[model samples]
Target chain A: MIRIGIYGLGKISRRVIQGVLSSNNACLYAVCSSSIEKANIFKKEYQAEKAYDNYERMLEDRNLDLVYICTPNYLHTKHIQIALSYRKHVVCEKPMCVSTKELNDCFDYAKRQNCFLMEAHKTVFTPLNQKLFEMISNEEFGEIKSIDAQYATRLTEQISDWHFSRPGSGCMFDIGVYPICYANRMAKSSIFRVSRFQDEALIEYENGCVAHIATSWDVDMENTAHIYGTKGSVSCKNFWKNTEAAVNGSKITVVQESDFTGEIEHACTCIENGMIESPVMSRKASLEILKVIGV
Target chain B: MIRIGIYGLGKISRRVIQGVLSSNNACLYAVCSSSIEKANIFKKEYQAEKAYDNYERMLEDRNLDLVYICTPNYLHTKHIQIALSYRKHVVCEKPMCVSTKELNDCFDYAKRQNCFLMEAHKTVFTPLNQKLFEMISNEEFGEIKSIDAQYATRLTEQISDWHFSRPGSGCMFDIGVYPICYANRMAKSSIFRVSRFQDEALIEYENGCVAHIATSWDVDMENTAHIYGTKGSVSCKNFWKNTEAAVNGSKITVVQESDFTGEIEHACTCIENGMIESPVMSRKASLEILKVIGV
Candidate 1:
């Protein structure tokens, strides 16, 4: 089994813990939190084998084969570098790094340390997305022409939330990455130019496809993604967590349960095969997404 | 009773005939077609009073108070000019003119002739759209932030269709005008800048609100319109012919039967009241929509 240690006690970390617990080839080995009491409570509640208040001390555990960094966006680079220095495989959350320089540094360090590092954007690992990738590869929907993706939230009242006030917590990094990643996948080429007005963006790819991405904190939008092709089109509601897709107005089931387990399982499978990067979500793709976000 | 004359014997004119026939105070007085056989057949089928192969001859009918110009896009300016010279009220279809110069000239001539000239954009006159306009006027959803609208058709095999081969029949002027009109209504301001790639456009209004409009002949799209505001949002599916709207996830029936009658009725009411333009779809609004499309 791949022994996993998580480094946060936030809401997203809880979902990651659940995913690890549900995976057949992974086990929750340890958890680190700022508060010992909270760490102990989380370890007991989630059936983790060990709990530590200090992150550095937890990294000293030789038995832990992997570390899932669920810290804040600004702390991702620091936490990921520490995990890689410990010679442990790393799974960092989305917006892996705020800047392209930091992303490049992390990849270089991971390669030098001979440790695997993957950004945990679970949306792409969902069964629906996998099938979409398959369809695009096989040209089931013909050549892709354009993509429209949106992720907006109606959180105007949540003024005190870090998502609104934090330095690196704008919609571009938090939610805009989803559409950018999907657009990158569908365009299958580098984005040559981009024009943005507030939280809305129009991205032009080198392959003649354009992507319209909108993310907002002021309004509640239909969190959906649409892929338009020459022959037909596909659409899904809540595409980031979608389990079913509609192709040419006909519904089809893509997965049984749309959860985070598929991404976790993918990480474990890559580690088992002694690969440093997942074939589906590679390091180069992750870097490209960050470059687009940072732009 | 209001007497209506129609120009063009095309698919859209058939719908216009149906709308006029269904109205309580309107009668189909005359029709003009390039082909005399088609004009006579249309007049006979729709029970019109007269048919003329020459458009100029049809405009000479003193009994016809208004003319519905449903000819090809290239012929709109010419037909409207002729009708205005004859001192007849006009209801031209969407994309009232292809260029700003033509739009300005038509409006100026209509004003000089003391005749009403309204663009028959049925979407904005629907009951649902009226309520949305009222809500926006009252700031029920707070300040508008952005609007996303799309209308795409999958007609890859119909290469010979005018929508693909005609000079002014690209997606921008065809289906793209719908979203442009909707965005213009919601923005309530002039669009200062626009960036376009193929059929997709991003329009930035002077009031800091941006509109993302996508129209395509290459693929199928959701055909939906979403308006995002500071406090909440509104969405309508098949917005061009929508009868229902959702405000913050609560569905409301806005119209009993969605048809072209609302616009036709509005035109009749304006002409009855001796007004020179429709209050709902004014001459200025029509010109602005055409300007955006021309861009």
Candidate 2:
């Protein structure tokens, strides 16, 4: 089994811990949290081998073959670099870092350390989305002409949170990345231009396909993605965490829910095969998304 | 009863004829078509009083007090001018004309002729949308923040039609006007800037309420509009011809289907009251929408 160390015990990290425990090829080895009490409780509840209040201490654990970075937006690059220095494969969450330069640095450091690095964009790994990719490749819906994707939430009470703040937060980094990733993967063409305002963006691909993506904390919107092609179209409601899809008005059965398990399973398989990155969630794709987001 | 003459016996003209026939305050008086056979057939089928192959000859009928200009996009201004010259009230289709100059000219002529002129944008008159407007005015959803509206249709076989042509044709003029009108009336704030690409646009209002409107003939999309406010949101599926709406997730029942009847009824009421413009589908509203469309 690939022994896993989880950095951060935030809400998302808890899901990562559950995913690690559920995976057959991975085991929950350690957890790092700023609060020792929270770390101890999490370790005890999840049956993790060890809990560290300090991130550096957990990174030094030689038994941990991989580390899942689920820290805040700004701290991702630092944690990934530290984990790579210890020669551990890394799976970091979305908005992997705040900038393209930081992302390139992380990839370079991972290459030098000969360790695997992948952004934990779970949506792309889900069976539903995989089927979508396959359909696009096989021209099931003909050539894609346009895409409309959005994720909006009424976080009225959380306006003061980092998500709406100036630095390290905004709807673009928080939720807009989902559609940006969708556009990048599905467009299958190089993005030639982008026009954005506040948290909304319109991307134009080289092949003339255009994608409109929007995210907002001011109101609630249907968290959906609509992909339009020449012959037919595919729509996935609650696309980020979808368990089903519809193609040409026909429901597409999705066997598994989009959870962290898929990414964890894929991460373990890639690490075991001595691969440095995930085929589904590649560093190049992440870079392209960040470039569009200008971060 | 108000005698109505329809200029153009095209597909939409048939709907206008049906609307006029169904209204208690209106009667189908005359029809103008390039094909005399089609015009006579339509008049007989709809029980109209007269039919003319020449548009100017039909406009000369003294009994026809109102002229519904349902001609092609490029012919709207000329027809509206001719109807105004005959001192007849006019209800033209969406995109009243191809340019702001033409719109201003038509409005000027209507004022000088002492006649009413209204665009047949049926969505604004629907009971479902009226409730939404009332809710916004009452601050039921707090201050408005954003709006997303799209109308896309797949015309794969008709790619060579006028909808895909250059002058006075494109998705923006054909369908993007729906969202533009939605934003114009619902925003109640002046749009200060717009960034657009191909068939998509992002309009930013003075109060920071950004509206994203996209339409295309290249693909099929959810012909829906989503309005976002600070407290809650409202989404109307099939928004342009919406029969239902949901406010904060509870369905708002729509009483009347969004057909030409709503606008026709309103136009007839406005004309009977000696008004120069519709309260719902106002000339100012139409001007604002056309400005955003830039044609």
Candidate 3:
């Protein structure tokens, strides 16, 4: 089993824990939290082997094969460095660092430590996104035209407590990365510059293709990504799930296509066979992703 | 007296000639057309004293104050140069010249002529857009945030023959420029770069703000500009009307705030006052606008 110790007792951490336990090749070995109260509560609740109130103490356990750094924007670099120093493979969240410079440093350190590192950009790794990319490459959609992707959530009431804090806690880093990363992959180009309004940035590429990204921690949206091509168009109602396509003259309504089958077992097999060689969350792609997030 | 000659007997020329002749300070003194038959017809229709079958013959009419160029895209630079050769001022429409290099040539001749010249981006002088600018400047909506503006018209069935031709004509120049211009004014920055997908390009600034522009000449849209700010948001349902704003939490929507009552009239007055020192459409702005036209 690939034993894992998860850090950061947030909602995402909880979700990851559940997904890990549910996966056949993964097992949750321990949990760590900054808050002692939350750590003890989670240790009792999840019935894990141990709970450490401090990340350093949690890293002392030699039995853990890997560590998942699911912390906030600022602590990612520091946490990853410590986890790698302890000779553990690491997977961190998106917008891996504040700047490309910091990301470069992390990449250098990871090479020196000889530890596996991934940014956990799960959207690109999903079965739905793969199918969409495959169809696009096969010229199934004629020629690519434009893409509009938005992921907005009402975080004002529920998430303002930690989201608007100091040291880069904002919508762009948290949720904006979703659309930015998706648009970059769809267009297959690095965004050179970004035009920003209140919270929306229209990212532009060297080739003159533009991606309209709308992300708000204070609004409500279903996280949609719509692709408009020459012959037809395909849209993901939420993230990359349930994609629907239509051509220029079709009288189609704005309904989500219901037939996209999830390739859960296929992705698991890819992982087990070590066939997923192209890391969906590469350091170069993450650097480009962070440039928009830096805004 | 500002004596003006109009080229091209197209629909835009029809309205512009009428507007210019109706103005007391400007007179539509001459008409030019590639076809002598059309020139004679236009001369009789508009009651213009002079008719020129050739563009050079009209340029020889040295008494003309300005030449309003309404020819096809490829002919703009050629006509502007001919007009400027005889020291006549020029007013060309949007997408001033087919390409940025061509636009630069137009600027060079305008400088050589030492006369007034501009692209006719009249939407900026519209009452609605003017009020939108003032409201944002006064911080009436608190801090400015994001603006989403779209201009789309269905063209599949209605596209004119010339619209699909190779030399010029597309959505980016036709209706796309309006949103881009408005967004530029509202955001008050030059676009860093643009992304081109098929026939569309989305523009963004370095600040992380975005502008969504679509022009299909083949699709129908609401044709509106939505401006979102911190205190409240304002929107204009139609480009030709004034926008309305509400203080973030308030129920009252104020339409046509007191400051800008008659914007087009003010533009004319500015012209009369030599406050029109620069043409209504500055050469620099028009050149940048042409860059996104992707010609």
Query: Which model scores highest in TM-score?
Result: 2
Per-residue error for A183 in candidate 2, Å, reads 3.4
Best model per lDDT: 1
True contacts kept of each: 0.70, 0.60, 0.11
Quantify how close model 1 is to the true structure by its C-alpha RMSD in Å: 3.2
**Tens-place lDDT digits, model 3, residues B65-162:** 67888887667788778777887777776666778788777787677667566776656665456656677788776554466666765455565655
TM-score of chain A, predicted model 1, versus the true chain A, to 2 decimals: 0.94
Model 2 bad stretches (over 4 Å):
A156-161, A164-166, B156-161, B164-166, B291-294
Q: Output the better candidate (1/3) by DockQ.
A: 1
Q: What tier of docking accuracy does candidate 3 attain?
A: incorrect
In the range A1-48, model 1's lDDT, one tens digit per residue, is: 999999988888998998888887889999999999989999999999
Q: What's the CA error at residue A3 for candidate 3, in Å?
A: 5.5
Superposed Cα deviation of residue B180, candidate 1 (Å): 2.4
What's the distance in Å from true for residue B16, model 2? 0.4
What is every candidate's alpha-carbon RMSD to the true fold? 3.2, 2.9, 6.8
lDDT of 2 by residue, A1-295 (tens): 9999888887788778777777779999998899999989988999999999998888888898999898888789988999998888999988888888999999999999999999888777777887898999999999898888888887745343655554458878887888888877888877888877777888888888888888887777787898999889999997877878889999987777326777789989999999998877888888878878876
Sort all candidates by lDDT, best to worst.
1, 2, 3
TM-score of chain A of 3: 0.81
